[model samples]
Target: MNRYNLSKSTKTALFFLSLLPLQWGLMWWFNLHPDDLELYYSPFFEAISTLQLYSLAWLPFSIGDVFYLFLVIWLAVLIYRFIKFKRNRLNRFISFLGFCALFYTLFNVFWGFNYYRRPLNQQLQLSSDYSTEALVEFTCELIEVANASHLSIVENDTSAVNFNFSKSEMQNLVFEAYQEPSNFPNKLNYPTENIKSSLLSLPLSYAGFSGYLNPFTKEAQFNSLMPQYKWPTTMAHEVSHQLGFAKENEANFIAALVCINSKHKYLRYAGLTFALKYSLNDIYKRDPELFKVMLADVNEGIIKNYKTSRQFWEKYRGPSEVIMKQIYGNFLKANNQPKGIETYSYVTALLVNYHNTYQLF
Candidate 1:
């Protein structure tokens, strides 16, 4: 009996050990052939994600969040056992490696390969480069549209626009926003909507994330505690991930596109202002003086809304948040986003160039 158990353990460890090189080779091959990756892997992911949504979307809460909670607990137990038991240390360590190998394989099969697919701009045939002058012009246009949207919602220009709907209602609106097929240049088929407010909202806020998609379950989880004004775009961003946009910047662009094109006024406002915020930040980086001048032209109400969001995040700012962000940034860097967390702001380039052809408002 001991010999049989030992043989099974050794075979399991060998299988996992072999998977490491095989997974690496697949990733390398996909990275080199993005066109093939897009043609093959992306469609496969969409089908898999659709099935995941079909299976999980009926639940009222985030199953993905629960899965993560249990995952942490399970890992903690494993570590504790390894530390407490000096015997069978090699076997324990091998088991841990096997766990990691399985997770990596599942992650890549589910969503990681999307990172190696063709760039969204190339797929959409939008220009990838723009001059500083073009950026300024687009930013000015966004400011005008955002100001109009804000005024349409509130009586006074100085008063911030408020969402009367609760978070649950907003989630429904996000679903409705994506239902229209004509809203996007490409066919963004979103069937079986599975967005949910994360049970980890408070912890997620402390970790400095607005929302994220669970690769394993294909659930879109947003921070429920975030300011409602930002919810439309943030929710849309996660849904974009479910649509197989793995890059943060591309998801941002798609989210903005969805919101801006929606018939609902609030969604339109959220999308336009979201794009404007990124564009303004980009301007501040390129020419601070120009940004300051442009800022004055935006409505006071819109600026107040931006301040509210900043204050919410500021309340949770800490060393732990910094560390969390650094870790996530490194994860992004490893996944083909060279700019890491900063890759999000690259959405500005896409927004500006997209507007050149699409007419953002």
Candidate 2:
């Protein structure tokens, strides 16, 4: 047989082109295909369920996010060498990546054309014309409705559902601080070295990116410096992603609705808190003073929490975020969202639209 010689460019090109089916399957087909995504993942998740792990942590997303920064750095050096020494293999590889990137961008744009309405009709996410005090009052009232009546709570899903809920017992959970040493679902803690990362040094991540459920470890990481008060909402949002809610808008709506109905006070507030944040603009239009009073009620702890998170990101932020955004914007467009990163804030629209079609739970 003749020596098989394939350039890196050709191999890379082939790999991404093969992934086109995955792109189509996840974006266009799943929504229309009647729970088709779940059908594809049943056996896979069953296997993952056996692992039994939980995490309040994740790999440092800054320099340590999938070793992406190192990969990019290496790519840069490789490109420089190729230009300086005329290496055909490196040139081919770069060419392949460039092609893949271009294709990814176009794929999002094309698919978004058919799916724009998903975002357009989501109005509940647009805040209410209520003050902060009113927000707190309304949110608390909803939680009480869930609590006093014990509306309906089943251990909802048997497999890892990851949707955030207030502690099953409300009063007991309030005073009890969340202990970091709490065991995983089945109690697996070997104590990998934990390091504190600077949030300020980093950049704003893709909103739901923190939701990744590591296929290998079978763990979903949660990192929200926003406050324990804010934790329930973000936690649920991320967990929804872990549960395989791929689309950001769907995850946002599900997270909030789930929390609102949770038994625990904090979890209930967590969902309502997030909803309030998003709905602030609408509230301001109706009553600005109410918003100010609501702002005053915000405990100092919440402010400090934001500070810690900001400082952490400031530690490792640079060009990575913008570059990644540009690349991923294309990917989002390539997938289902035509607006790219802008699709996250649009989740409220999804929430509003869903509520309109279905009676609010």
Candidate 3:
């Protein structure tokens, strides 16, 4: 008779592997019951995230970036070990699977589950569908507001509006904006202040990401190297993610709302123009002639600001950016956003419908 015993590593790996099914089952349940997620899980997330913010917010630099750097290095070492060593190959592969299972579990528990929350449109009581005429009306109003905001910041109609505040100042402004009583129906409670200029700004800019929220650390990381005109809204967007609006379009809509309602003129400009840019793109898709007509009415300074942003991105346009975007798009699809990266533009529907009732200007 021959006796075989499992290694401790194999046992540990099996334990983690056992968790995968439970995690998947819970995710499915949450997906089917989004209102429960919003009512229960969202509040839980807020409570835990507030604690995370308290822990990590005071640091001057991003601990989340460092965590990612170390994670990549660890993965590389694991891969090299797996490839080079022939001994205990089964154990090694199983351990890797265990690590992946653990990571997936932690991600969902900490932040990914928020992806299953009720849609922002429904929460705000805004319609998701709108006619072309309604879009044109909302967009025209947006253009007028954007032009007024641009003129308020700059002397002439031909020059781009400049952001006079530093990154820290911008973060502070966002904090103040969220604290406003009328800005959000529920108090957003942004005092912990975890927003940071990313240490990976150069690489992030190359990857075509404006900002991201770190699920593990609850820090909002914005690419510092991007054009200044993009700063306020980008910061607001990431802050929205930290506040548990996990979907990109929801974050965009929330950010725009926060900024437009801000007392700061610069933030208001950032918000209005940010909304205008998306509205214009939607119009172009639906009716190009109407798009051209509406765009021509926009102030020259706002046009120059748009051109400046385009030229900034144009400098980094390449195959790698496309690949990065495609990967992110697929990731979004896996996380309940079926339209993938197109989900970002879905903010237009929310904006248009919200404006119908609230009047954005």
On lDDT, the candidate that comes out on top is 1
lDDT of 1 by residue, 96-137 (tens): 787788888899899988888878888778877778999999
What TM-score, computed on C-alpha atoms, does each candidate reach? 0.96, 0.51, 0.96
* Pairs of residues at least 3 apart in sequence or in different chains that clash in candidate 3: none
Clashing pairs in 1: none
* Clash count (model 1, backbone only): 0
Q: All candidates' lDDT scores? A: 0.87, 0.44, 0.86
For model 1, the superposed segments whose C-alpha errors exceed 4 Å read 1-7
lDDT of 3: 0.86
RMSD of each: 1.6, 10.9, 1.7
Runs in model 2 deviating more than 4 A are 1-38, 41-66, 89-91, 94-219, 224-228, 283-331, 339-361
lDDT of 1: 0.87
What TM-score does candidate 1 get on C-alpha atoms? 0.96
Q: What is the lDDT for 149 in model 2?
A: 26
